[model samples]
Target: MDDVIIPVAFFLILAGAVVAVAYFQSLRNRERDRQWADAMEQYRVVVERARTEQEATKLQLVEMSHQVKALEKLLLSVD
Candidate 1:
């Protein structure tokens, strides 16, 4: 009976330790997943901002071209 009790107590202690380690590992994984999601969201916002800036630059270029053409025509008329 004494021998049986010692082994049973050791087994219970080992099982508890394993359970604790698994719980902590689960928590770590959840945190990592959340960080990944946040990074992806940030990346999406940055990409959208870049696209908007590109469109604005395109509009500016078009306006500049029209102004240059008008200036050329006015100078020719002066001559």
Candidate 2:
């Protein structure tokens, strides 16, 4: 009876420790997942901003091209 009691107590203690470690690990994983989601959202915003800037730049270049063509026609008429 004494031997059985000792083994049972040891087993219970070990099981409790294992459960505690697993619980903490799960919490850590949840925090990591949240961080990853936030980073992805930030990345998406940055990409959208870059796309908008690129479109604005493209419009400016097109406007500049048109202005240059108008100038060239003016010079030809002067000649």
- Candidate with top TM-score is 2
How would you encode candidate 1's per-residue C-alpha lDDT over 1-79 as one tens digit per residue? Answer: 9989999999999999999999999999999999999999999999999999999999999999999999999999999
| lDDT (Cα, tens digit) per residue for candidate 2, span 1-79 | 9979999999999999999999999999999999999999999999999999999999999999999999999999999
Q: Where is the poorest 10-residue window by lDDT in model 2?
A: 1-10
User: Which residue segments of model 2 deviate by more than 4 Å?
Assistant: none
Clashes of 2: 0
Worst 10 residues of 1 by lDDT: 1-10
